[model samples]
Target: MKTFIIRSFIGIFFGGFLAVLITNLTIIFGGLEIIDGPLFVKNSIGSILCGWFFTVSPLYFEKRNLKLSQQTILHFLTVTSLYLILALTIGWIPFTIINILLTLVISIFVYTIFWVAFYLYFKNQARKLNDCLKRL
Candidate 1:
């Protein structure tokens, strides 16, 4: 359980960092404005929370024999709802639509990358453990 929490935190942190990095990169390339600091903070937090939800939801759904489509829909709804609530609580800005959309896209991309990285890491670890056990 502790390992799971640590892994989840790492996933969320990296996912949030990736989104911020991409956003800043785009800004540096003159693609978008830097926007307000508080808004960006909200976005980063939302991305991290969404990343956690996205990482775990599918596993829970799968354990319950849920369809992929159902899982996808639930994931979308869950992330969207959380984003909206956080944004609202943080105060609405005129660029709410753009903020929400950009955050959602970046969060999804970062979360996907984190998921793949974690999956590969665990797979390799499991293989090493199996090999060690066989040798023992």
Candidate 2:
């Protein structure tokens, strides 16, 4: 519980940071004006919650006895659904079919990149551990 709380805090901070960073970047590159204070705050809070869930949702994999593929599918679906709902509600993405489809495609791409990176990293770690055990 303590660890989870700590992780959640980290996620919140990360989310907030990303929200600000992305907003600033968009304003800079896209020539968009800064939004109103209340709207900005709401969007920031939404991003923070999104980040919190994205961080903690993986804890489900720890407790479940499902296969790796099954766990991945479930996690992806759950996280993606949460993201879409939160994004639409917070006005991060407009509630249009085209916008939703585009957001979904981008989300899948980002998730795939992360999944591949983590998979390779863990596989390498496992190999190194196996080698150490063989020497013992």
Candidate 3:
């Protein structure tokens, strides 16, 4: 349980950092100017929340014997839906479409890397715990 909390925090911190980095890079190189508005804050918070939620989702579901593929799909759908609703609430339909597309592109890469790291860390811990239990 302690390991799970530590790994989740690490994943959220790194994942949030990566998402910010990517957003800045897009503004720097892609010629996209950062919009300063309530929507921006909404999007930023939504991304971080999504990162934390997805990071922990797989671990929680795995204990119930859910397959990785199923967990991944479930996380994707759940996060995407949450993001869409948040975006729509902030900026209506057109802005929500834009937000969803951009968020999807950035989040797919960021979360995939974070998820893999978290999974490997927890898997190793689970193995170690199983070994310790067997020894007792």
TM-scores, all models, native as reference: 0.45, 0.82, 0.48
lDDT of each residue in 6-98, candidate 3, tens digit only: 767966786678668867877899998665667556656666665676566556465667777787788777876775676566553356556
Model 1 TM-score relative to the real fold: 0.45
Off by over 4 Å in 1: 2-4, 31-35, 61-136
Per-residue C-alpha lDDT of model 2 across residues 7-69, encoded as one tens digit per residue? 899899999999899889878999887667897789889989988998888876675578878
Q: Whole-model lDDT, candidate 3?
A: 0.71
Instruction: Tally clashing residue pairs in candidate 1.
Output: 0
Error of 3 at 82 (Å): 1.4
Of models 1 and 2, which has the larger lDDT? 2
Give the candidates in order of lDDT, highest first.
Answer: 2, 3, 1
What is the per-residue lDDT of model 1 for residues 15-125, given as tens digits with 9 covering 90 to 100?
A: 698768966886889767557677677777766776776565445445467765576567656765675676566564345778778777876887578657866997999
Give, for candidate 3, the lowest lDDT window spanning 10 residues.
Answer: 87-96
Top-lDDT candidate index: 2
Model 3 misplaced stretches (Cα beyond 4 Å): 1-65, 92-98, 133-136
As a whole number from 0 to 100, the lDDT of residue 30 in candidate 1 is 72
TM-score of 2: 0.82
Better of 2 and 3 by lDDT: 2
